[model samples]
Target: MKWLKKSVLLIAVFAVGVVSGSMIWTSSANNTGLVDPNRPGSVNDPLITKSYVDQAVAGQVKTELEKQLQGQLEQLDKMLADKQKEMDDKIVQFQKQLDALISKAGGMTVVELQPNQTMYADPGATFIVRNGTTIAVSTDANGIPDVTGGKDLMDGTPIELNHMLIFPREGRGIKSTHSSTVFVMVTGGYTVMNPDGTIAASSSMDNSDQNETAE
Candidate 1:
């Protein structure tokens, strides 16, 4: 009976030792909260120091600070752009005031460029105004000319060359055989005009004026 009691005591002692070790290990490792510093995740001993926690915290703070600084810089850029626009408006206003003052003082105010007027000065532009013809012109995004139309283009916007003024109601043609000849789009389809102004080829459109445009 004494031997039996001794064996049981030995088993109890072993069990208690295991439980105590586990508790200590869990407490040390759980407290390392910061990236398992102190090598707290080591299989041997676990537990981190204040230094590790501080370093990890510092790194996170630096990241957040950098993001904040970058946002501030973007905002600053937008502010500068707004300020620049305001300054430009002021300058334009001053120029107009100066022009008015000169005219009031009886001095000839030779205005070079007016706010409401634009001058075409491209030497390569062509001005071919037709008394009885509609104008066909190229356009930019929103229907404005990207490049200056011939010297004749009005500064405002381009008129689409989609109708009889430029196109053949419902026909195709030898757009231009010459290097780049502008074909006069005829309405009621394409009709090859005879020397005497007669229809050579008829497209048979009842009589609409939609036409092909230049690329």
Candidate 2:
């Protein structure tokens, strides 16, 4: 009976150890389910769905397309600005050339005269006498004198006279010294200059005419 009781106690202890080891093994298997390939809902399972992959790929492609579009737009803006500047430059150059042409077309001509020299004047021309020299003149578009380096002459301003008229000296009245009267062509009509340098107009002078003057 004692041997039988010892044997029964050892059998009970072995059965308890087997039950405890079986419980520990079950806990370890439950913990390892997250990393196991054979278990469902584990780390090795495919987590990336088709919808998620498609969305990621679409987002990357959209970003690349947006970047390329922005680059093209920037390049187009630069090209337009450069073309506008080039057109503006061409317009400015054309304007300068046009202005030069107009200026040249509207310019005037001048002729210098010496003492006792006679020159035929145009119908719209003027005669200016200054500093022992005479000048035939015309006006520009601005009605300004067209003589070279000359300005509008004003009396009593201490300014140099660009145009003058003949005035006899004191006690020397003009008298005829030639056999025939000398003719001086003026703007509107012919002027008769006596041998003694006296001047007479062929017709009545008009004050409204720029080229017509009375001295």
Best by lDDT: 2
**Candidate 2 C-alpha error for residue 141, in Å:** 24
Alpha carbon lDDT of each predicted model: 0.41, 0.44
TM-score of each predicted structure versus truth: 0.33, 0.34
Writing each residue's lDDT as its tens digit, candidate 1 over 92-157 gives 677557545654674322222111122121222222211112222233222222233322232232
Task: List clashing residue pairs in candidate 1.
Answer: 125-151, 126-151, 140-144, 167-211
lDDT of 2: 0.44
Q: Kindly report which residue stretches of model 2 are placed more than 4 angstroms away from their true locations once superposed.
A: 1-46, 108-215
Per-residue CA lDDT of model 2 for 122-176, tens digit only, reads 3344433222322232222222233444554222122123332222111111122
In model 1, which runs have C-alpha deviations exceeding 4 angstroms? Answer: 1-45, 113-215
Q: After superposition, how far is residue 68 of candidate 2 from its true place, in Å?
A: 1.7
- In model 1, where is the ten-residue run with the lowest total lDDT? 113-122
How many clashing pairs per prediction, in order? 4, 1
